[model samples]
Target: MANTWNTDNAGVSALASGDFDGDGHDDLALGECREIADENIDDPCGPEEFAKGGGIHVHYGNATPGSFGYRQQTLNQDTVGVAGVAETGDRFGAALAVADIDNDGRDDLIAGAPGEAIGTRAGAGAATLLFGGPTGLVDAWGEGHSVGYQQDTPRVPGVAEAADAFGAAVATGDYNHDGKADVAIGSPGENAGSGGVWLLPRASVNGSSAFTPAKLGLPSPSSALAYGRYLSSQ
Candidate 1:
């Protein structure tokens, strides 16, 4: 709870809740999509930090209603075991989703950085996966923990294009009627601004290899639709 408020332009732009510690009480994840970094453990938002690098803060819950535990941790690309680098406009926590992606009973976290650059393509977008463990969120899963996915990634479909904004929104569900959860990433700027959604099944995610994805309900180019701008799951 220390240093929770600062002048770092750390906007709480996104949020998710789950039993990340397996402690029965649901924990909260707050996304500061416009955060800049000082990396000062005592004060991340101190004067030294100023830019839109983005980050997420986890607040473990207490047994008492509307209460959080003493433990709090903030995550960003700079954190050990996390993927990518904390850069201006990465916006790492612009969108977030929680699910038992590995089907290991513990719910995992998926964070979207819609403004991330891919290769030389600015704003090509990306998403990061973090596993949930007994202690809390960890990037320790052998196969796919703390992995970053973009259009040109091995298992992910499509080509990396500028201003695609692929991770503008995110959601999870059993899209293929499988027992494990699948991920859907939104690219609101894809295909000349028509927008697109990519569906990655559990098997594809587990394999960490190239696989074809179902492009959910796409509208024609002339329709001028941003089809994947927002998403939610039951």
Candidate 2:
């Protein structure tokens, strides 16, 4: 019988793919950004009390060719090794990007939780970086193997403000011609509707530092442009 999973209003909100296991066949990552859940482990997917409490499902590819029918895993803030806590409106998997940030031959996953609160700033938005390894996605790093990015993070531009939506969209590339990958994050709801994009270097992905797009000489957009409503990179 074919494997099946179900949830109401927990539709696939985002997607990305990579050979997470280095098995040559590409794997799949699906985001159910509208998923609802609570702290009740007894009834993990219930009550609808935590709307927009998103999650992701990963399916490693099989040898069948052109299929991703291998083992499956579900992840969310509440997952034992994942970072953060599941809260109403956090929308953890609303956006996703894939890249070999560390150039370790394994592609990493970048997730956006546009409704996350930064400190006391509700809806300030945030991004989570999950690394991949020979054994598939692994959280071997001390900080749950997951690193978070937000407006208020040290060296990251801007302050954490309500509705900033920093993780509303995401994309990745080697912007500086560096062998490692860089990331671009969108805050379409920033600056009272004047959206902005932030570019984080590969070093940042490895727990080093951050850099805004402007520092790379990208011109800023006009007021209210909502520049990062959608973003892309090679």
Each model's lDDT:
0.70, 0.70
Residue 145 alpha-carbon offset, candidate 2, angstroms: 2.1
Off by over 4 Å in 1: 1-10, 33-52, 138-145, 203-220
Q: 67-106, model 2: which lDDT tens digit per residue?
A: 7745655667876566778877888878888887777777
TM for every model, in the order presented, reads 0.80, 0.78
Model 2 stretches with alpha carbons more than 4 Å out: 1-10, 33-52, 138-144, 203-221
lDDT string for model 1 (90-146, tens) is 888788888877767677887889889988899989888887787678433422247
RMSD of 1: 6.0
**RMSD values, in order shown:** 6.0, 6.4
Backbone collision count in every prediction? 2, 0
Angstrom error of the Cα, residue 91, model 1: value is: 0.7
TM-score of 1: 0.80
